[model samples]
Target: MKNKTVAAWLAFVGGPLGLHRFYLHGMGDTLGWALPIPTALGLYGIQRVQQFGQDDQLSWVLIPLLGFTIAACALVAILYGLRQPQQWNARFNPQASADAPAGLTNWFTITAIAAALMVGAAVLMASLAYSFQHYFEYQIELAREISQ
Candidate 1:
C-alpha cells in the first residue's frame, strides 16, 4: 500500500524529480516523466547565471520554472498530508480498506506538511519577487533609453 507519509515526504523532498508520482502512480506515469524537464532547465538556468552572470535573460525565465515546480510539489505534499484517511485510501490505496495503516495521518505526516508549507511559500514568494524585481528594472532601463 502507498503510505500517506511516504508520499508526503517524497513530494516535499523529491517532487522536482517526480519521486512521489513514481511511488504512487508507477513508472509509466507521463507526468512523473515530465516533471524533471523543467527542473533540469531550471538547473541549467542556475548554471547559466553562474557562468554568464545574473543578467542573462534566459536564466530569469528558466530559474523560476524550478522554483514554481518545487512549490507545486510542496503543495502536493501538503494536500496529501491533510487528506482524511478515507479519502487518501480511496484514491491511492483503493484495493485496501479505508482504515489501512498507510492512509493514517501521524506526526511525521504533519511534520512533512508543515515543512512543505514553509518551504513552498518561501520559494514561491522568492521566485515572484525575483521575477518582478528584474522585470521592473528592465522596464526602467528601457524607459530611460527611450526617453534619451
Candidate 2:
C-alpha cells in the first residue's frame, strides 16, 4: 500500500524528478515519465545562464519551466497531505480497508505539507518575477530603439 507521508515527502523533495508520481502511480504512468522533460530543460537553462549569462533570452523562458514544474509538484504534495484518511484510502489504496494506516496523516505529512508550501510559493513567485522582469526589460529596450 502507498503511504501518505512518504508520498508527500517525495512530492516535495523529488517532484521535479517525478519520484513521488512514480511511487504512487508506478512506472507505466506517462505523465510521470513526462515530468523530467521540463526539469531537464530548466537545468539546461541554468547551464545556459551560467555559460551565456542571465541576459540570454532562451534561458529566461526555460528557467521558469523548472520552477513551475516544481511548484506544481509541491501543490500536488500539499493536496495529498490534506486528504482525509478515508479519501486517501478510497483513491490510492482502494483495495485496502477504509481505515488503513497507510492513509493516515501524521507529523511527517504535516512537515511535508509545510515545506512544500514554503518552497513552492517562493519558487513560483521567483519564476514569475524573473519572467516579468526580463520581458519588461526587453520591451523597454524595443521602445527605446523605436523612440530613437
Candidate 3:
C-alpha cells in the first residue's frame, strides 16, 4: 500500500491509541494514550464505589465491560499502526530531519503555540468532566426520589 493509504488507515483506526505516535517512532507521542490509562482506571473505580454504596451490584458489571472495550480499541489501533508502519512512513515525510530554528524567535513561537493548544484542550476536558459529574449526581438523586 502507498504511504498515504496506510497513514489514512492509521488515522482512522489508531488515532485514539497513539498508534500514530508509535508509527512516527516517537514514544513521546504515546503520552496521549498513556495518560488515559489512569483516567480509565479511576473512572471504573468511581463507578464501582458508587454502585456498591447504592447496593446496585449490577452496575459494577459495566466497569469491566467498559474497561475491556476501551483497552481492546486501543490495542487494535496500536496493532494496526505497527502493522502498517511502512505505509505511515511513506505517507508522511519521514526523511525530513529536525533542525533547530535559525532564529530564537521562531522556536519560541512554535513552542508557545503548541503549549497553548495543549493547555486549552486539557482545560476544556477538565471542565466538561466536572460538569458531567455534577449533573450525574443530580440525575441519581432525581432517580432515587422518583423511585421512592
TM-scores for every predicted model: 0.98, 0.98, 0.31
Worst 10 residues of 3 by lDDT: 96-105
53-92 per-residue lDDT for model 3 (tens digits): 6344443433443344344444433333343334344444
Which digits, one per residue and each the tens of the lDDT, describe model 2 over residues 1-148? 9999999999999999989989999999888899999999999999999999878999999999999999999999999999999999999999999999999999999999999999999999999999999999999999999999
RMSD of each: 0.6, 0.7, 12.3
Pairs in steric clash, model 3: 3-91
> Which is the leading candidate under lDDT?
1
Candidate 1 Cα deviation (angstroms), residue 90? 0.8
lDDT of 2 at 104: 99
- Candidate 1 local Cα displacement, residue 54, angstroms: 1.5
Query: Whole-model lDDT, candidate 1?
Result: 0.96
- Which tens-of-lDDT digit does each residue in 39-138 have in candidate 1? 9999999999999997999999999999999999999999999999999999999999999999999999999999999999999999899899888988
Q: What is the lDDT of residue 20 in candidate 2?
A: 92
Local distance difference test, candidate 2? 0.95
Candidate 1 matches the true fold with a TM-score of 0.98
| Lowest lDDT 10-residue stretch of candidate 1 | 129-138
Task: Please give the CA lDDT of all the candidate structures.
Answer: 0.96, 0.95, 0.45
